[model samples]
Target: MSLEKKDEHDHEGWMEERDLTAVEERYLAILMWLDKRLRLVDYLELLEDMYYKVNLQMPKSHTEQYGLDNKFWYWYPLYALGSFSTLAYLIAAVSGALLGFYYAPAAAASAGDPTVAYTSVTSIMVDLNFGYMLRSIHRWSAQVMTAAVFLHMLRVYFTGAYKEPRELNWIIGIVLISMTMVFGYTGYLLPWNQLSYWAGQIGVEMALSIPLAGEWVAQLMFGGFTLTQATLQRMYILHVFFLPFLVTALIAVHIGIVWMQGIAEPH
Candidate 1:
C-alpha cells in the first residue's frame, strides 16, 4: 500500500475506534477535508490568541466586577443611547441612498409653479411603489438619530463621562451633533417645495448673519444667496457627498476612542 493510503486507512480506523455518533463522524470528516485544503486550523488558533489578548485588557463594569446579575438594558437604558443613535443613522443613510436614485435636484421654475424637484418628490410619495414607506423610514430615522444623540450627550454630561481624558471625545460629540443637524437641514431642502424653499431662505439668512464670513458662507452653502437651482445642487452634493464622508470618519474615530477607553459607567 502507498503511504497516503496507509494514512487514510489509519484515520478511518481511529474514527471507528472512538465509537462516535454518526453526526460526529460526518462532522470530523468534513472538517479534516477542508482543513487539508484551507489551513483553517492555523487561522482558528490565531483568532483564539487574539481573543484572549483583547479580552484580558477590557475593563469590567462595577456590576461585572461585583458579580451582580443585573441585565444592562433593564437597569441602565442610557448606556445604549450611543448605539441606538448609530443604528438610526445607518438606517437613514441606507434609505436616503435608495431614494437618491430617483430624486431630482433641479429647481428651475417660473413664478408660482412647482419645480422639477418638487414634482419628483410628489411622484415618489404618490406614484412609486413603497416610496412613501421608504421616505417615512428615512425621515423618521433621521429624527430618531437626532433625538438619541441629544439624549446621549445629556447622559454623558450627567454621568461625568466628559471629564478628564474624555474631554477631546466630548468636543467630537459636540461637532457630531452639529453636523447631524446640518445633515437633516440639507436633506430637508432637497424637495424644493414651499416649506423647503423657505427653509433654504432661512439658512441663507443664518449664514449671512455671521460677522466676518457672512457672504462667503452664504455663497458657499446656498450658492449665490437665492433658493435657485444652484442652491438645490449644492445641498444635494453636501447631503450625498461631503457630509456623509465627514460624519462617517468622525463616527469611526469616536467609536475607536470608546473601544480604547471602555464604556464610562455612571457613578
Candidate 2:
C-alpha cells in the first residue's frame, strides 16, 4: 500500500525486508506497478475465467465432450482454413497500404492520354523501385484471401460448424465474405485502365437495373451512370479507407466470438 519510493534505497530495503531475491524483487515490483496503473489483477481474473470456461465446459475437456479423442479424423487440416484466410487478408492489407503511398485516384483524361490515376499506376510499376513486386504481392495476396475464404466457408458448411451457438459467427462469416468481394471489386477499379473502366461501367448498369432507387443507388455507389472522377474517388476511399477499418473490426469480433465459443472440433 505504501507507494512512496522516497529514495533509490527504499525499493531495495523493502525487498530485503520481504526476503525477496534480486529477480523476484524486480519482477514483483514491476508487476505491482503495472497492477496499480492498469488494474492487471482484474484482467488476469477475467482471463482465468475464459480459460476454464473455454477449456473445461463440463467436467471434461472440449475434445472429450465433442468425442474427438477416440476417433481418427482426417479433416483436421481443413480446420485451419479460417486462420489461413486471416493470414492472406493480413498480407493483402499490409501490401495494399504500402501501395497506397504511390497510388492516385484522379480520373481526368484527355484525348489519347491516360488519366492521372492510370499514370500513377504506371509510375509505380515503372519508376518506383520494387513496385512491381509490391503490386504483385498485393494482387496475389488478395486472390489468395478470396480463395481461402471460399474454402473456409465450404468447410464450415460441410462440417456443420455453422450450427447452434456458432450461428452468429456463421452470419458474421457471410458478411465478411461479402465485404471481401466488395473490397476486391473496388480495388479492381483503382487502376483507371481500360479493363477497370469497362468493368465499372458494368457495375453502373447493374446498379441502374435495381427496380426503384436505381439512379439513387448508382449515384451513391458509382457516383453516376458513367465512370468519372467521382467514381474513381469513391472506389479509392472505400477500398483504401472504409473497408479496412470495417473488415478489421469485424474480424476482431469474429475472433472474440471464437475465443468465447471455442472451435468446433471433429466428433
Candidate 3:
C-alpha cells in the first residue's frame, strides 16, 4: 500500500517467499520497475477486475433462454456483416499501402501525353511485377468495404439495433460511412487520369456550391478553383495521411462502444 519503495530486498524477499521460478522472478522484476515509474500495476489490476466481472454468468439470449437456437441460426449471417466490413477494410488498408509506394499524384497535363500520375499508374500496371494484381486487389477491397459497410448499416437499421442505447454508435456509423466515401473519392483522384480529372472537377463544383463556405471549402479541399497539381497533392495527403488516422481512430471507438454495450439482439 505504501507508495514509497521498500528495501530492494523486500521485493526480493516477497519473490523468494513465493518460491518463484526464474521466469516469474524476471517478470516480477520488470513489472516492479515499470510500476515504480508508471504505476502500470494499478491499471493491470483494474483490467483484471474488469475481466472477471465480464466473465460472470449472465442470463442467456432470448433465443438461448427460450430454446430457439434453430431460429437464431437462420439470422446469424446478418450478425457477421460488421465483421465482414472490418475484414474488407483491413484488406484494403494493407493493399493500399503497398500500392502507395508506386503511385504518383501529379496532374501536369501534356498535349497528347499521359500526366505524370497516369504514367506512373501505367508503369505499375505494365512494368512493375505483380503491380497490376496489387492495384486490382486494393481497388476491389475498397469497393467491397464500402458495400459491406452499407449493408451493415442496413442490417442494423432493419433490426432496430440502432435504437435506444445504440444511437451514438449509429451516429458514429454514419460518420464512418461518409468518411469511407471520402476515402474512396480521394484515392480515386490519386491516379489523375481523365476520369480522376473530371471527378476532381465535380468535387470542386460541389464544394463551391455550399452557400456560405463555398469558396473556402473549395480552397481548402481542392486547393484552388481548378483541378491541377495542387488538387492532386491535396487528395494524396488526404487519402494517405489524414483519413487513415481519423477513420482508424473512429473505427476503434465505434467497436469499443459496441463491445461495452454488448451487441443488440433482435427479440
Name the top TM-score candidate. 3
| lDDT, candidate 2, 1-267, per-residue tens | 778756764655777678777899879889878987999999999999999888874555567767776552567667888898899999998899999999889999745589989988988999999999999999999998999999999989987889999999999999999999999999999998889999999999999999999999999999988889999999999998899999999999998999888887766
lDDT of 3 by residue, 1-267 (tens): 799877865776777779788898899999889989998979999999999999999877777777877766788898888888889989999988988898877777655588888988989999999999999999999998999999999999999999989999999999999999999999988888778889989999999999999999999999999987999999999999999999999999999999988888767
lDDT, residue 233, model 2: 98
Model 2: residue 150 alpha-carbon error in angstroms: 0.4
TM-score of 2: 0.77
Candidate 2 lDDT score relative to the true structure: 0.89
Q: Which ten residues in a row have the lowest lDDT in candidate 2?
A: 68-77
- Report the lDDT tens digits of candidate 1 across residue range 12-122: 788887989989999999988998899999999999999999788756677688665365445477888999999999999999999998898999863558888888888
* Number of clashing residue pairs, candidate 2: 0
lDDT of 1 at 243: 99
CA lDDT of every candidate? 0.89, 0.89, 0.90
- TM for every model, in the order presented, reads 0.76, 0.77, 0.83
| Alpha-carbon RMSD, each predicted model | 7.2, 6.7, 5.0
